[model samples]
Target: MSTVGRPPGRGTDEPVGDLVSRASQQISALVREEMRLARAEMTQKGKRFGMGGGLFGGAGLIGFLAAQASAAAVIAALALLLPVWASALITAALLAAVAAAMAAAGRRQVAEAGTPAPQQAIDSVKADVTEIKEATHR
Candidate 1:
């Protein structure tokens, strides 16, 4: 369905230049397709990433409120006969545990995502360069 791959002056007995032009056009089309594929892949990932970030933000907001409420509870417990430092120490430990869990989860997500954009772009560019070089030499 692509006329671009047809050598120039096809019916008129084309020369080598026509062949080169056709090759170039085919290479161009291949590059465009690769680029389109890359963009679509990244766009889909970006949308999922956006949604995940929104959910994370909402969760973070709720967690912050809960921590604040815990701090208030700690203060009330201290006022009612619980030792102040003991309450604060317990709250601090709880916050540290939560922070460690969140950090570990975030790191796992980052590792799973890998180098999506840059690695794909690099591979595609390398392929295009190799194709162009071969086309030119032929």
Candidate 2:
């Protein structure tokens, strides 16, 4: 019975040069496959980063709204005992603090990401180098 995946030549006793050339071809194929895997991995990482950041931003938005409402409620509660200006000032400060905190967290996360641009650029250069090597020797 013939094996479906094996080429007939794979079963042959071939010349050493033929084996070497075939090995080179296989190496090239392996590199191509590795490049593909890396691309896929980076894409998945980017997707996860986006999804996580989006979720975080969404939560932050909800929290911001809740914070503002709660601050207003606190101000109203305090208005009974405090001057109008003092109550408004305290609530405004609380809201500003919350906004600043969220902004800082977002900025830090964006900085940590530092963009996928560098990773993709490096992979492209590696692939180009591989191609050039094959071309030069041929």
Q: What are the per-model numbers of colliding residue pairs?
A: 0, 0
Clashing pairs in 2: none
For model 2, the superposed segments whose C-alpha errors exceed 4 Å read 1-13, 90-138
lDDT of 1 by residue, 1-138 (tens): 555867664554568897799999999999999999999999999999999999999999999999799788877786577677777777788879989999999999999999768988899999999999999999
- Candidate 2 residue lDDT tens string, 1-138: 565787765755568898899999999999999999999999999999999999999999999999778878889887988987799898888779988999999999999998768898899999999999999999
What is the Å distance of residue 2 in model 1 from its true position? 28
- Candidate 1 lDDT trough over 10 residues, lowest sum: 5-14
- Evaluated with TM-score, which candidate comes out highest? 2
- After aligning candidate 2 to the native by TM-score, how far in Å is the CA of 46 from where it should be? 1.4
